[model samples]
Target: MTTFGAILKAHHIDYKLTNRSSLDEWFYSILDIPIDELSIFDISRSIRQDVFLEYVLPRAEVFLYEDPLAGDYDGQLLYDISMLTEAQPPSIMAILKRISAYLSQLDKHNLDSQSIKSIEKISALVRN
Candidate 1:
């Protein structure tokens, strides 16, 4: 298994030592500021698509599953993800297929309207 640090290293995203229990926490800790206030484009511009697929994409489910509005205050995983997808990286088809599956399994009834809208946008974007 690739250590979370290894993935961050692969992306050239630097971080200081910290006490974090999970990969999710470690992922957030590296960011200088909140992801919502940051531009996904800026953060991921230099990231290799293959590395994104191998490391980031596989973690999409864990990220989305932490929807803040749903009472999970983990962070804006979806926010960054949505923006990244909107950027239309070369492996977008694979991204769409992977994230679409995550979105599909969502209990839409439990999601707030805004969340639903966001998911719809992502889904629709992938289709086009």
Candidate 2:
């Protein structure tokens, strides 16, 4: 099934960004946090960026619930991001908007327009 990993794979989005010192630094800050205590509230307390979402999706279950959807990386690709963006940190949602390019590049056949707009609106709320 097309999971987050699958979609990212389609885009050649590197899952191995830990090799970059900047990404590695921010990644570890979140990664090092105790997952058990991790909350959307706390996670966004530090830094919020589109890159971070990409960085965190593979690792979301460490803190958030495993993807509720049975398919698609169990929901890391969209659901958790949906929830976090919906929660409206404003800044977080703003950061999320940065993924627009990636989302646009995603094969249209893989995601329907309605779903795409839904996500766009999620991030756009901060700008509006």
Best by lDDT: 1
Off by over 4 Å in 2: 1-75, 85-90, 112-127
Candidate 1, 21-127: lDDT as tens digits:
56436345544433333233323321222324434454454445554232123224444445444455656567666776678787778766766666676677677
Residue-by-residue lDDT tens digits, candidate 2, 20-109: 677465554554454334444433332245444433443433332232221233323444355454554555454556544345455545
Weakest ten-residue segment in model 2 by summed lDDT? 63-72
What is the Cα-based lDDT of residue 83 in candidate 1?
49
Model 1 spans > 4 angstroms off: 3-54, 65-75, 85-87, 90-92
* Model 2 collision count: 3
> Candidate 2 — which pairs collide?
3-72, 3-73, 67-74
| Global local distance difference test of model 1 | 0.51
Q: What is the lDDT of residue 36 in candidate 2?
A: 35
TM-score of 2: 0.33
Candidate 2 lDDT for residue 121 = 58
